[model samples]
Target: MSTTTEARSGFSPRVALQKVGTSLSNMVMPNIPALIAWGIITAFFIEDGFTPVPALGGFEDAAGNPHLGIVDPTIHYLLPLLIANTGGRMIYEARGAVVGVVATMGVIAGSDELVTMLNLTQPSDEQIGQIHMFIGAMIMAPLAAWLMKKLDQLWQERIPAGFEMLVNLFSAGIFSFLMALIGFYGLAPIVNGLMNLLGAGVEGLISLGLLPLVSLLIEPAKVFFLNNAINHGVLTPLGLTEASQNGKSVLFLLEANPGPGFGILLAYSFFGRGAARASAPGAALIQFVGGIHEIYFPYVLMKPALILAAVGGGMTGVFLNVLFDTGLRAPAAPGSIIAIFGNATTDSYLGIALAVIGATVVSFLIAALLLRIGKQEEGDIAAATAKMEEMKGKKSSVAGALTGAGAGAAGAASAADDSGHTGRIEKIVFACDAGMGSSAMGATVLRKKVRAAGFDDVEVTNKAISSLSDEWDVVVTQKELTDRARQRTGSAVQVSVDQFMNSPRYDEVVELVQQRNDPEAAEEGTGSEAAASTAAGAGVGVGTGAGAEPSADEGPGSATAPEILSPESIVLAGSATDSASGIDEAGALLVAAGAVDEGYVEAMHDREATVSTFMGNGLAIPHGTNEAKSSITRSAMSFVRYPEDIDWNGNPTRFVIGIAGVGDEHLELLQKVAMAFSDPAQVERLEQATTTDEIRAILGDEKESDA
Candidate 1:
């Protein structure tokens, strides 16, 4: 575990495998609808199907002339090409997909040629059949796409501007041609041999009665979001081949069996506690009836021990299938019972039904026992869901079902409803004249919030207004410069703010990014409660007027208090002529404490010049320019209360909290300060509190004096 942690911080072998499986699954998951269509067509039109159409099924027509049916061509060409294109896009987007398709065409042709050559050279009772090249497409597509990506990167910005189209077109074309040759001569034969090996291995597993053990792998992998990779990437192609020879193959039922998930959900409904118990019945409905196996993953994740149930159920299902000798005519996507029966062989209905029932019962019994043993340990459904998504690197579509109403508004209010931008916000930029002062500070603050919300992929950067590009998803700027920033880029959501530090709008921006990444989280009001609680512990929203007053037992002199905000740093009574003077006074306190240099005061004024430090709720946080970090440096904060409301820009400020943050060391403390003052009631209590100790208690944590 330590080695895994050192290998990749926050990622283990399980997560690494999940990522690989997800990537492979992504190539085929999108094309399941097409697979379903082909399956439906095959189930009805094949010669052995219920309503056999000779011409459509590729059988000899009434005139005895052979016809190429839709089924054979669809399987031989369409499906493989679709998989190749999808795989290519995964590597390098549309261009990669185009190259991938072109390369795969060569593999398909080479496979046919290989079969023709074999049939002629070794003509015997058993003629060599055409290899479908599904695996070949999966291999060649990504490889061709990756090569294209690397080739493009080499000439990326080096391409002479005006001739970019000409260079891109011809380069891709030439690269595609070369890749096709490689796929034909190099990849096709290798992939054919690999597929033959894999097929033989499966046959061997079946004959040896070891096939049921596959459930041991599939069940756990599914919980980690690798279900699609196993079911589609590995099983679907093999099943297609098997179905072509035999009327149906049991391979399709292996991973797509819904019994295990249903059983686990049923167990949760009976034995689980809290949100898991409440949401289980509904989740079971979605899992068993709706065919979304992902809905039950959180239940297993919330209690990893419950995986035994899934394994038990899955093994039971497989064993039953093997015992009954039942199979499906085509893949049953979503693993829904309806789809299962719909694709079942003419004689497989009873056996498949029994398999599902037996699997469910076994899983339920095992899961119920596990849940009963740990009945007191309530599952943190939201946390597990977040972990699952972290492992998946994206939100699951049906995972919301498990969270249900237990999901809270940990995230700030909905910003998409009012932010005026509906599109997804992936990249955010803070723009100012030089991008050195207020803009950089603002970006740092928002970036922290975004990270706290678990949006590691969303990029936040500070850029000079002149350097602003069209690719940004959200552009944050001071109201004074928003117009200038807008003129440079017309599409990005424009967020105007009055302050660089502790602005309410920052919360809105964080919420907006959160919504775009995880709509369910936003809808459920999910944010980082743990981070918030940590911040709260550091002191936030604990004021008397805020409805909570610390007892005499817990005051400023308490031993557990953070030392950053000590008695010397807090002034109960402070005075300033105006906002400018107040900011100077605040910076002077930091300078006096040796927390910053004299130059930091000037940067504070410069930052103020771009945007006011006056945040809402009668509070203002004056801070130096983002470029002035070198001026001096211990992380420190000072609290000054003005008895008279000082005129800050236009908003009356009763509290002026000065900050000199060193890197992100002061961010958690800053969050504490923001949360405390953001509330009007808390601000009111803060304004009325006469003692510095009283203010400390209200904010949350007490301050510890220097030893």
Candidate 2:
């Protein structure tokens, strides 16, 4: 024998029986409560208006009704079977047969409808036979299972690691479709064969005086996974005829698993305790009348071995039921209460009592014995803990940091320099209304920009516009926030941009900063001195230009009088500067031109709300997508924020704001802008510059002269 089979054989009969019993109990325990509730509902349906027939008279009713329709009883048995069977399939195989069951029912019902339609005129016998075959095919279909399995395998093989969740949903859809087909055409014949065999054996068992013993075993056994599969997977799709409505079928009692209920009652009856004693009566009330059985989860979990005992008792009960030729129209999940109203023979109550007694005795004895023997380890606690710890650590790593950021953007950058403030601006505060949306966006944009700009010691934060103070080094704000920022930072530079929020502008902003810091270097390549000399000659030609020119602050050659303005400091901030480009597309162009880091542009796309930075009128400023702190080396500035407002979140915006940072370098850019804006002429000159090249020329010339 194989190792597995040898292990199985090593168990003593009693132990082996106990193991089977536990598996059965585990399968049936959770379903008991829902079954009892459904059973009561079935009873009500029959009692209200449905008619009962004598052909289905075996099952007793609490109301003492002699007749009940097959439909009502069939429903009672069918629903519980469906739930138990489906639950079992889900537990064991992680796949449910419900779709197949439904499809089978639909095909049969549809075929019946077609026959009825034909009968309205007049139907032939052959036609009816054909319809029956069609129904049979529908009920026994197998194609569904094959299709579902194929699709599951395909998804498992092809789906990438990060996208597993999306694949699971796709697999579920395929599985559901296949199961529906199986229910219709793959299950009918098997049910019929079982019924035929049952019919042949019922009489012989009664004649042999084996009815009671069979009843004792059969009823409980049906509660296991195997019988549950047949009941739900087969009998339910057989069509709810009048016989089933009248509670005539033997299938009803097979629906519910009374093993757990019996075990609980016996336990309480024999070992009454403080809470256990009090709960016993309630348990009996629910089990007997309500038919709910989930009251046993705690019991089983506490003493798992008892589960096997319960299963053993259930199996015995089912066997006895079959032997007695007892049957129920409706299936009961927790069989205790609803079985009373199901279809049965004249001695139906005897069958119920026998099932209860047999199952209880077997469960109690086994449970008591197992309890005395002590518990076995079902799982390794230490291994489970270690596994959990490992998972937790993985979750805290870089991969975990990017879950919501989308596959394209996750873990794109480490948090090594993400503090927002590192090199320079330690007391920078960004302000906007509500301090939530716009300010947050502005802070993120600046942080990323500063980080990229190589300043790692800048601290940038956001606050409500009204909360600004003089403690801030550079107060950055939207036009709407300018007034409040001014009040908060007296004497400190209040940099107000026309855009709603600051966005990444690494290239242009960095270029502007470089020029401002070193005018000689900026003028090195560009003929700034020559441009100034030409402008001076033109002024001289205007007659008073020579006289109007301010006298050199120093005598002729004394260090050439600090020019007072830098050429490269000039910039406009709006979308009109690049009419042919989207903000991101333009930002990309700038990045490619040694303007900004590519990471900043990528971050803008990741946030989904990158366009929000262009608040209104002739303006489009894209910001960083990350909420985590970061920075850029410099901010990119454009000439005309924008002449006409671009459609930004449905509002018109004119400014095209771009910020690029190395790391915490935002404060320097802010200070530079503050100094530039301090002179109104420079701002006006930028607005009127017309072309991007002209703007660059004007700013370039101004910086050299100032130096």
Candidate 3:
């Protein structure tokens, strides 16, 4: 709701790097379950971990000691296939995964020993190549997948009608075979060399004392959601190769170190006030223990200076990691204290714990210094409030929410005159640089709005802007990403909304879609048509959208629109006052009747403190926030009319509507409230009425309350 411009307004190489990292991160995310399972198998059953569960076969060693059999094939061959196929799916879709896995076999078997049916132990170790192949698979999977995608495109363009199946099947088989050969002959050697070179580079850095410098790129990238890609695509494979030789590799500790995030959250927990302070404990727990380091992204985003804190923490951790020469048997999946311990070597445990603790402490100190917690949060609130009031209804000046960036693109698109052109939109896709963190959240918000507004069939989804396709009906993205998304989506309706978190324009999208899907709703003043929601204070009604047309005023308990307001009870206004939260006369009545709790009244006040609830002319609807909904036992509605107007968020309120919704039922009820509020005549009539029954007629309510 703040009017400040976002820090992501411009682009730079760092931004692009972060995007690549995010792309790799999101691409590898679906494979996490597999990776975790593989890591656990390696850690527990492969004889490298504390409680070594035997996998292959246990036998006596040369010294008559028990030698636990290790499942070398599972880690060397199967894990690489799973990793490669996963990366493949991200690049070329499902078919890419099949090709990538198939081709990876070449890397696994290319220089390896072969058995002869005619002879025993015919192939010697000298004739065999035993490259771990994680690096090889990583390089070749994307290559094979890209070729498959290109071939699929070619087949689509040129394949003949009945021969399609035969040609497609044959082409895929040939390509898979060729890719395998190519992986063995071309990509595997190159990838193997590159892995060694990178591994050597790490060793060189450690020797030269430059290993800690990795944090310079890492901390900022982690802030941008590159945590997964940097860990899985770049680091994990390298660690596997080193771990194969040394029983563990410090490479595993590099990306999975949860220190920076933990540090940042720790700072917030101590220095932050208000909601930031309240949320920090949970966030810290998740970041450090749950291993979801992304939990602190917003904290850094809020104060960019905190990135330095993260950097300091990351560097400190890396320094300690190198100093101790510590490593893990497998990648710590969650990077949680538990996961790290689970994968830890006996020698590496102290180092890992120390590194994480050191980083956490460093990050906390830096973030606390940067947070400027001593500054009064609301010292400027009074001034800002005055400025806000002067600019009320002129919300377009605000940068990212409904009025700012979201308004420009969506407002233009949803304009009445632009309606004819946008009528074809059937599905909407939100695209972002990284996709999930911003674009996915944006898509979820819009989708909920779409469903709330009664357009269920309109598909809503998110993808990396790199994945935007021309087939999409519409593409939604932040202003900075719109041009890129437009170029990729190609003539698809592209809309730019600022701040993917909260778009004021999603309502516009819902309206446009409603009109497109239910043409009758567009007709103004239709007797049986639902009205599309505009910005806040939009009229709500029941008609062709979800509920039935307003039934003939049946006097209060009628099921005119069950999906609309399920009115539970109504009480006329009683002794209400001003200056506090609301004229609680209405709230007390509802609470007295058990329709809602006293908490509902307090919730209404809390909402009012942030913004006024007064509808224009003479009405106010009060309800707890989404977070406050836990106070309500069920979905219900109640109303209390005031004899005199009480100040409601600046506007006078004679009618107080109390709503408690379970699930999205409140959203359905909101439509009717909007309709009644938007009409000056109805509001005027309600103000003149002295009884709840008269108020019911004004609200298009036909029946008595269920109570």
Candidate 4:
């Protein structure tokens, strides 16, 4: 939510960028359906030649030849209505929707209305009033919605019970009518004038050989998750106009080019690691053939500077469009090469291909340089393959490829985590960016799995990320949008997965739920030989290997040991009854006491599962792996003392001290801790201490001897 408490905390460049990017993405998300649907209609319903299908009441032309007969109203009516509804819905719900349509109609009104209403004659010399289509709808819809929203606020909760229906109906109708009048009389001329000015500026920029400069903003916007917004809300309308006038418009080629993404994935093929390498070819097939350009977004996000590759790629595509006059007749829904070629003009196909190739090559080279592909080692290849296996079925393909590959080093495969645990799970919800298309499909796949596993009592539903709640047992979202889901549901466990359609993790989730209904199952299944013990170092300050200081010299702050732990940081607890609750409490306590970042808790659990933190002598030290260093705000230690030992991965641990060390910065602390806990009797003495001063006396003695 706030770039992870483990990441930059406050006003940093990184956090600032996230806010800006998220804000832009939200603005255009709701309107995406209208944009894509309109583009689809234009792409297929319209004609390329006169000798088109004659199925719909085709009439012979002056030459007595059959031609296309069906009327295509995509641009004239459907697009304006769809855009108007989208804009209105952005401000309010159904009321805003009605106002938006009415306002759009109002904006398109002209003096010709007088001719119909009052029988006035129109002057032949005067040009008919031209309706502002896309731009006008966008403006008027929001304006109308705002006015309606204000009216609704006035009617807030005061209406009599029986009069509620009457008031609601009348309020919406009157507000819509009033807003429509405002749109016609006040906003129309001003909005239309601004639209024309913008059009002129764009046209001038294109003619002056500055069109490629557009990518500077467009590419960044795309990275901000506004690719859909820019493509649909702004560019598609402009392209529609150009297509009407010139049969095709280069404007469509600017943001919708798949070349840059294609190029990045191609580079990953050569330079990327395990999952990344294995997933690249499949992603390429989907990106190029299936037209889902979203598959490549995660790759770019891995390195934000990689956006330059997109900019360079987009600019090159636009450059070729200018040089060769290439443009598609409609927006490319999937932004795939196949779609682009399908929608392009016959004469421009070769030019479009060349432009795409140029973008791909340029981006690939840039991405390769950025990735430093040659540096990856062969040992990681097997690990990556295993991660890829976690993603099962077409969910990987249907959702987007390259998800598991990018998080190659995450290493989520842990005995404790991979194995099911005992926890009640009544609800399972699949979430996504929009939480409709992909998530719904994912929920269906998971639901089938749940049923097949004979767990039909479990509820599985899909909803948008914004609608996610803490009441749900497990909330799953796509890898890229996991932060958004986390922000919404802090208490609920959030699963970061690549695809919603299908994943091997679904079975694990179901198994966990089953184990929850029968907690004994988890214990029975997990019964195994005691894990290989760590060094059974003696009491708090008794015996230690005389040569142990050599290993200490190689630890944190090597060649320089510093006093890192303090008595004031320790907290003595009566006992820990439950391992699960205790671990969570310990992690949260560290965060609350300002000892570590919020992300450290999750990372520490991950690290604990990967490698047992139990260091014997009734002690278990939990610390995140070096990879989790970013989650550490500063180097600090949190000591939670349990009088009665608790089960720590089957080992009894009396102390669960969490260390938030930056990389290997906690070496000095570890050495001091080792010396303090060296004697078995010293640990016993400290455990019996009732106060901080008493505990300090024991530690103080060890410090005195070390000095």
Candidate 5:
């Protein structure tokens, strides 16, 4: 892995803030249903509701007696507690949740105390309203839980054996009580003041006609996977606070409005070129009707200038909402038209409707004009899907299906030719989140396969997804990050894999590269590279059973540094029952051979605890961590084969190769081993080998023959 690649420098302010926002949203997103239920109840039964119910709405009854209602208590206690409990659980699970609720009660109590104090000091008409502690809960819950976790860790094993239950119970009770007092006296007042200031700021923004400018910040963040963060983290609590006090809030529409995404997709449908134009209509329906605004993020990213359309559309909606004083009684999730209507204030219907319409029109017109001015053609739907995945950093089945991204490795073969080049894949880049660890390992494995396939002209390197460029002929990524890789380049064929150590996809990529090379071979007609036969259907998954015909490339002497592996070190059908015992057996072999100290075996276990050594295709390469490198006496490897699988960190493992590498010395034999096992056929031959001699033959170096 190249460290110079565009790896995120330490602590990016943007990424850090986004992560914090994401964490806040995580606490609320799972509880959206409860918020929706509250919204429905308020819309239907509150004092100004269509059918007011004093009993449920907490209003004066027909007899002029006030009744406590579900509305007041739900917002005052239930919602805050729910938020607290969710926040706590995120920090420390059930124990954290308990402490969080305990602390939140104090905040709620302090809020009531403040309300009572205001009533005593001020005239009834000027008295302060009940301050709900939603913000306080958001703060105190996670804080209380984190403190409890650290406290418990302090005495984790110091407690006497029989007093464990008593110590735990009393400690938690005392800690909760202390935290509750802190919440009531310290955090609650601070949060209350903060909320008041924020509420006033929003009112000021609205009055000054500058509230619409928020769309500039919001619209761009949505494309970067921060939609939930902005919606649930910043807006929801404030919107809920306003709704609790005034029965409706415009804040909900700021991010939830679907008009902007819908308009962008609609514009693409009419003015965009290639697959973006073809797929825009369906994406428009998903965005507008399905309330999945994320579908249109790719369209904006494909042509970054299109974000102006989103900003304009967002501003138009907010401007209309401000002008008409239109607002929803509850947050409109999915930003769907139906949801928006369902949650609108009774008198705000026309205004809300117009806001949506105006937003859509503005966005569409802006996007259409930009498309016309730029005239940039999106390569194809596959490229669009790749771009979508690249930005999202995850494989989206919906994106693939929506953009026809399912073309897989086979479709990548035409990528070179499609771009008006002779079909040749010269540069391959392996990408992961940080472009380290597993990605580098996967690249090494694939690079070995590519070289063995006789495509030595191909360049293989590992890169952080952030550094991916269009210069590469092919880009490979782990399954989780494949979607993110797609957005990096339009010309590269994209490949995804679950197992970096041995993926069938590696063979498929090698085959694609070889196919691209075949055209050049045919043009030459008499080159030895063309004359040399390749194993037929070598890329196909085949078992290399005993007596199976060898691939032309796997001839004897192809192995590099053959002395590193010997028949004496090979063990078949080992007696180990599980991964630990299996590690012990493999490590013992290396110990006896003087390859490593006994401490190295323990280090291997530690390394395994950090990350599983399991490399796909039934192989686990157990090695000591960097800290344990001093235990190595020489660069050597020992192989142990288990006929029956041992579970190696949830992956079924049949082979364990204990390695003690002195810098890059071990990479040579490691590469040869990768080449042998990369072919399922060769792996099958090793599995079926009855004698140690046969095992040695299969495991021997098979680097490309120099002669």
Candidate 6:
């Protein structure tokens, strides 16, 4: 099966449905509070007799011609639109409130033009109100967005964990105060000035005429990125106003635009000869009738320069609307030929036809130019495609292995016998720097070799080297982790696999395992048993009946052994050490080990000048991960001491600087290092050690301590 099909198959239908439901809910949910606020306002207007249409449905007498009623019709028609526009803007433009709020206000004013056309309210007064609302909205949206972000950050950090719900409730209260501030102090003057300015034609030109100019000036490559920002940042918020004005929620505009289907069609069009020729026909059908503008997005994205052309076309269309003094009463819904009829003037058809023709021409010309200038190489495309496919395959294989392992574990548990014993072998864990790539492959090969040699009692697993310890019966790893693994597992056998550095020999490994498990079977009816016994009688320790010196080079006393230290001794020792020098020394050691870069030591020293690195206890793990220019492979430890007192975490530190070289793979080591420090006996010995050699001896000790 193709990779795409496999990826799709991995996601359950229920999960896909849940994602859809969540997206829909998020888009619509913000309007609920706005609806409640508007409802209260509407009810107040009705009771005050300011409403033109009564709540219970009755027009007041013309003789009484209530002033309240005159204002009521305008309020009733415009308030809902204002709330929706504001709320919708908030939802879509999550990060930038200023743009969203202004766009929403614009949407409300734009949509209110529809009410004027319908004769629900007088045009002059409504137009003035529209201008006021637009200006007010523009100012408030950004302020609200900023306030929301600040409150969110404050709640996440300062509030206690369990009081999250209370914090959310408090945020709402704060938002209400902000809203009130805007209504009383912020909105009034801005609205009044905007109404006055909008009276002149300059406002129209500034708002609409500049669009085409801006589009032309922007670099073609950057236009689509800007377009995405504008749609989410500006247009979505505008939809809110439409929803609020008509008492019809238009939140779906945020989701429906620039449809995914169009993108798919455009991508296929690049390879499909027939599809490219029919592109305009398909776009016209979907965009004009179905009102799906996204049907063209794929085409635009395929050649990004076309996006600039589209922007140019859009700006031109907006400018023409201004020139013709045209206004949309409602947001042009189902954005197509038929929908335009609802809002179109005598010049509307001509405006739209010009927009489509101009946009198409720009897009086509730019695409053709780009294609002609730089045709893609077939070899490069094929290579990239192959690499992508390989990565996809590896991911699939790993996922399948994990799934199979989980299922096997479950089955084993369920199939236990009456003796409460399942026929499952114990897991043998092998670890290194990064878990489960090379190590995992090695484990698989080792497991096969072991099983073939009839050692089926164990099942092999691989993990990060840092996790190797008492977790497994026998820990297997490369030479680098030999010292660390031995420190963690005192008596537990550790097999350092040289096969990692060299090519693996499966047959030799199988034979070795067999020999280790059954010495008597191999020695049967042979004089070699006598020779082995003779060797054993000698002062030599044999591994697999092979005569070899246990201490090959050094004397028995020279073997590194573990040391136990008391917590009090550790503290006292640390008190005598110079803390600053200790940290510097530790940094220097790491640099020498090639685990960290040189300047890193200096940076750490500089950081230390400002604050102490001693987190707590007698432990001072001083290190720098960011100093290295390239990726780190393993962590390195450096032991240091001061002859005199040094201030640690408010305590005098004598023994200091436990450097940990942390890389992507070495995180596990940090945990083990932490465990080592936790032991009071180890801490005492670490502090008491006078020389670097003494410290290394104590650390290298494999024996268990009673402290």
| Alpha-carbon runs more than 4 Å astray in model 4 | 1-73, 110-131, 301-305, 369-400, 403-707
For candidate 6, give the lDDT: 0.40
Please report, as a residue range, the 10-residue window in candidate 2 with the lowest summed lDDT.
Answer: 393-402
Q: Could you tally the backbone clashes for each prediction? A: 0, 164, 19, 16, 12, 26
How would you encode candidate 3's per-residue C-alpha lDDT over 263-375 as one tens digit per residue? Answer: 88888777776655666777788777878665576566556688999999999999998888788877777678888887787788888889998998898888888776534
Error of 2 at 125 (Å): 19
Q: Judge candidate 3 at residue 521 and give its lDDT.
A: 51
Error of 4 at 646 (Å): 38
The global Cα lDDT (0 to 1) of model 1 is 0.74
By TM-score, the better pick of 1 and 4 is 1
- What TM-score would you give candidate 6 relative to the actual structure? 0.32
Error (Å) of candidate 4 at residue 104 is 2.5
User: Best to worst by lDDT, what's the order?
Assistant: 1, 5, 3, 4, 2, 6
| Candidate 2 structure, TM-score to reference | 0.32
RMSD for each of the candidates? 15.8, 23.9, 17.1, 19.6, 13.3, 23.4
Compare candidates 2 and 3 on TM-score and give the better one. Answer: 3
* Candidate 1 lDDT tens digits, 367-463: 9998877755788776776556545544445654665421211122242233222234568898876454345556755665666556667788887
> On a 0 to 100 scale, what is the lDDT of residue 41 in model 3?
58
Q: Which scores better on TM-score, 3 or 6?
A: 3
Task: For model 2, give the RMSD to the true fold.
Answer: 23.9
Estimate, for each residue in 214-319, the C-alpha lDDT of model 5 and write its tens digit. 9998999888766666677657878988889889999999998888988989998998877788888988887788787878877887888989999999999999
Q: Name the candidate, 2 or 3, with the larger lDDT value.
A: 3
Model 3 residue 533 CA deviation in Å: 13
